[model samples]
Target chain A: MIRSVFFVSDGTGITAETLGHTLLTQFEQVSFQQMSLPFVNTDDKVEWAVQRINRAAESDGVKPLVFSTLIDSQLRTHLVKCNGVVFDFFETFTGAMEKELGVTAQRVAGRSHGMGNVRAYSERIDALHYAIQNDDGATTRDYPMADVVVMGVSRAGKTPTCMYLALTYGVRAANYPLADDDFERGSLPAVLEPYRHKLFGLTVDPERLHQIRKERRRDSRYASMEQCLMEVRAVERLFKRERIPFFNITQRSIEEISAQLMQQAGLTRRI
Target chain B: MIRSVFFVSDGTGITAETLGHTLLTQFEQVSFQQMSLPFVNTDDKVEWAVQRINRAAESDGVKPLVFSTLIDSQLRTHLVKCNGVVFDFFETFTGAMEKELGVTAQRVAGRSHGMGNVRAYSERIDALHYAIQNDDGATTRDYPMADVVVMGVSRAGKTPTCMYLALTYGVRAANYPLADDDFERGSLPAVLEPYRHKLFGLTVDPERLHQIRKERRRDSRYASMEQCLMEVRAVERLFKRERIPFFNITQRSIEEISAQLMQQAGLTRRI
Candidate 1:
């Protein structure tokens, strides 16, 4: 069955969408047609959202599900009047939380994802730039400043992991791609020797690596099974010998990899 | 006063942290010492988390607040015995949702951020690579494949915005850095001429641009206030003259920018 669902928020709506997606994943039997209505802080926008929700309800022949993270109670009041089953996240929890914490909520809008702290925002941008500049071992001079350095063979999911770490946690992450030189030499790169403490490795299943590389360069030796197996074996051996922590990214998402890297590497989130 | 808060989950803990952070932001008067406990799927991990939460409650002289997205009910039963105010997200909403949808929740662990769908995961990675390859006008050969092309002067927040869009939504967002060449030409770049409908622009206040550029190249003409003003004005005029839709990202976060871009560009999330 297909149900209409909405993630409504006064801010970026990211939190609402994320939590709602998590909750909906438990119901694999039902398919959801999802929409996000963001920046719904005004009464007019609330009315507009109500119209959309009511229309969805009418067309779908069932009440649409509205997962709301709207912090403004007045706006949320307007939202609940719609012909939908509302799961008001903030309203559900904030009342109990206020009594427990013995403090009143500020009820301000857009504070979650807005540029509320300029310094933290700038640091996040700086971390992203660092990841870009230091990608693929472009420069090791700044390795001392890196919170973590990720190493993996080509297509082993290094770049995306580093970028996710930097953007999500404000952690300065640099990545290096291990190639024939490192595998043939049978040792850690000379430049990475000094920063072994911050080093983390990633390896993928050989077949998976081959599949990934084949997409980039079809019918090439680089995408051959022999090449993929050899590189993965060498990288895993190096990681074990050097006592560097590593993860197998063959079955993991970038979010999972980044989070595990932070915990295993003992790297604190800068933001 | 300082309060301890924990975001606990059976998966990456990202959704729990996101929703918990959003709720915490409403209480500006309280300072939160926050921690995330991820991948707590087993009974052993549940016990470990209980010990940690209890310790925090004992040390802080106040009961900690636990925001949990644990999908497994038995694990959550053990968690609530800790000396903390537990806010179980799934427990709070799932029963109601089950009744509304007339289906039982699967109660599967780690489905939210797991690699449940391989095609979706690969598409997200491909989108990230597309953003990296097409960044800063590196190549325009693949412009036709992009959902949107973001343009802005240096430090006006194009690269990061594009990267965020790609990573978060699987949207192929390419960015071109507007430079002296585009301004001198007094028109869109020749490569971008055919893709006017797919174009979006980003602009920042000249003073903000000066500050951002100054951090990168101090005491250089590139960072000069005069240069910043000239570039911003020229690019904005080009946007106005060409009727290219644009946003001033001086006050918006990357999440906000990406969401607004998706709305304005009519880009649908692929994942």
Candidate 2:
């Protein structure tokens, strides 16, 4: 059965959507038509959101499921009156937390993903710039500042992984792309030798690498199956020889790869 | 007093962390030392996590808040025995959802942020690559494929915003850095004229722009306050003159900026 799911929030609604998605994924038999109502901070927007939820319920012939992070009690009151089964995230946990902590919640909105902490937010931006500056072996001078230096062959998913790490975790991740020169040398790049302790490798299946490369540069030797196989074997051997921790990115999403990298490398998130 | 909090999950723990952070933000009076225990899919890991939680509880002389997204019921049974207040996210709502939908959940882990949907994962990667390739006016040819083209002065926070949109929402965002040529011409670049509807401007405070530019290139004309002021004024004027929607990004985080952009531009998230 298909159900309409709404992630309602006073702020970006990201937390609601993320948590709702996690919960919804368990029901494999059901399909969900999801919508987000972000920036519903005021009474008018909340009223509009209520109407929208009720409309969805009427159209679907079932009470829509609402996963909410709305902080205002008045807004929550308005939301619950709608014809949907509302799971108010803050309301569900805040009362218990208040009793446990012997204090009342501020109940303000936009604190989670807003610019509440200037230093933390700026650190994320700085990490992103650092990643871009040091991306794909752009420079070796900044390796000392990097929390992790990801090494992989071209199109092995180093750049996106580094970007994700920086943007999400405030991690200073620099990536080095292994090319023909490194393959010919048959050793870790000389510049990366000093940062060996911080190096992590990503290896993709040869077939997948070939497919990715072909999409970028077709009919070239770099995209050929023979080249891809040789590169993958060489890189994997190098990772083993050097005892650097590595993982296969053949079938992993960026989030999975980043989480594994942070855990395996023991890198703490700056944010 | 400080309290310890744990976001424990069988998978990446990201959802747990995100939702936990949102909830914790409401209790401004309490200080939390938060930790994430991901990949606790096995009994041994769950036991270890329980011990860790118990340790924190003992050390703090208070029950820690444990926000858990663990899927295994047996592991959850083990966790509830720990010396912490466990908020089992899946357990809290899944029963009601099952009853409402008249179906049993698959109780799977790693589906939310996994490569279970290859096409969705590839689309995210493709969007990331698109953002990079089309960044800083790298090429104007791909404007047709761009969901939104962000225009801003150098260091006006375009690149990171576009990157965030692509990574978080799978939106194909391209950024164009407004440099001497565009300012000199006093108009939108001729190439961008046809795609005016897709354009969004970002303006930053001159003082903030000076600070940002000075960090990258110290004591240069581009980093001077006068230059910053002039460029910001010109950009703002251009945005008004052309009626291009713009927002001040002086103090907004990437999440806030991207959310605002998506809402203002009427763009739907592909993810």
Provide the clashing-pair count of each candidate structure: 0, 0
Task: Report the error of model 2 at residue A168, Å.
Answer: 1.1
Interface C-alpha RMSD per candidate, 1 decimal: 0.7, 1.0
| Candidate 1 Cα outliers beyond 4 Å, as residue runs | none
The candidate 1 chain A region of ten consecutive residues with least summed lDDT is A261-270
RMSDs, each prediction? 1.0, 1.5
Q: Which portion of correct inter-chain contacts appears in model 2? A: 0.83
DockQ of 2: 0.82
Q: Candidate 1 at B139: error in angstroms?
A: 1.0
Q: How many backbone clashes does candidate 1 have?
A: 0
Tell me the DockQ of each model, to 2 decimals. Answer: 0.89, 0.82
Worst 10 residues of 1 chain B by lDDT: B259-268
Clashing pairs in 2: none
- Local accuracy of candidate 2 as per-residue lDDT tens digits, A56-122: 8999899999999998889899889999999888888888888888898998888898987888988
**What TM-score should be assigned to candidate 1?**
0.99
Please, what are the lDDT tens digits per residue for candidate 1 over residues B1-271? 6899999998888989998999999988999999999989899999999999999998999999999998878999999999999998999999899999999999999998888699899889999999999998999999999999999998888989988988889999999899998899998888899999999999999999999899889999999999999999999999999999998988899899988889887888999
